[model samples]
Target: MSIKEKIMSDLKDAMKAKKTDELRVLRSLKAKILEKEISERKGGEASISDEQVIEVLMKAAKQRKESIDQFEQGGRDDLVDNEKQELAIIESYLPEMMDDDEIRSEVQKQIEQMGASSMADMGKVMGVMMSKLKGKAEGGDVSRIVKEELSK
Candidate 1:
């Protein structure tokens, strides 16, 4: 099933199981997806593609991560806990991200392929790496790895 369909199915299951936290997260996700669909609508019905859905999910997950960090920094343990729970739920729908080692290796490969030797080539390298990695890796991680590899 598509990611959107899976979310809908899981939303139903969460409702049936009386999972309050899961239900809240799923409902929020559904709302975000619907909002995205509406914004993209031009004339007829504009359904979001699986890739677009993933983009939405990734953005939501990123937001949750930022919230968790800010809450922790502000010493709001209760809010931090809540954000962590929400982050976990959001992450459940995302594809597995590349580990640091994998990201490092991929960055190295891309640098070699593009003959990127110095920091001046950072932008060119980043553009290719980001497009290649897409949803599989986070931009910050990829950029860090690329910088380390290029500086070597």
Candidate 2:
């Protein structure tokens, strides 16, 4: 099944199981996907690609992570816990992220392939890496690794 279909199926299951937290997250995700579909509509039946669905999921996951961080910093343990639960639910649908070591190795390979020798080549390297990595890795992590490798 497509990611959107999987999410819809899981949403139904969550409802049947009386899983309030999961239901809430799934409902929110469905809304976001619908909104994306509407925005991309070109006059006929509106639909989104699986890649677009993943983009929406990634954005929602990032928002949850940011909320968790802010809530922890504010000493709001209850809110932090709630956000963490939501994050976990959202992440379950996302592709597995590359670990730091995997990301590091990929960055190194890209740097060498692009002949990126110093900080001056940082932008060129980042553009290539971000497109290559896309949803598999976060931008900040790739940037930091690229900077470290180029500075050496």
Find the candidate with the highest TM-score and give its number.
2
Please provide, for model 2 over 29-78, each residue's C-alpha lDDT reduced to its tens digit, 9 standing for 90 to 100. Answer: 99999999999999888899888898899999889989988998999999
Which residue runs does candidate 1 get wrong by more than 4 Å?
none
Among these predictions, the greatest lDDT belongs to 2
Off by over 4 Å in 2: none
Instruction: For model 2, give the 10-residue run with minimal summed lDDT.
Output: 132-141
For residue 43, give model 2's deviation from the true position in Å: 1.9
Clashing residue pairs for model 2: none
1-152 in candidate 1: lDDT tens per residue?
88999999999999999999999999999999999999999988999988789889989989988998898889999998988898898888888999999999888888888888999999999999888888888888998888889899
TM-scores of the models, in the given order? Answer: 0.95, 0.95
lDDT of 1 at 145: 89
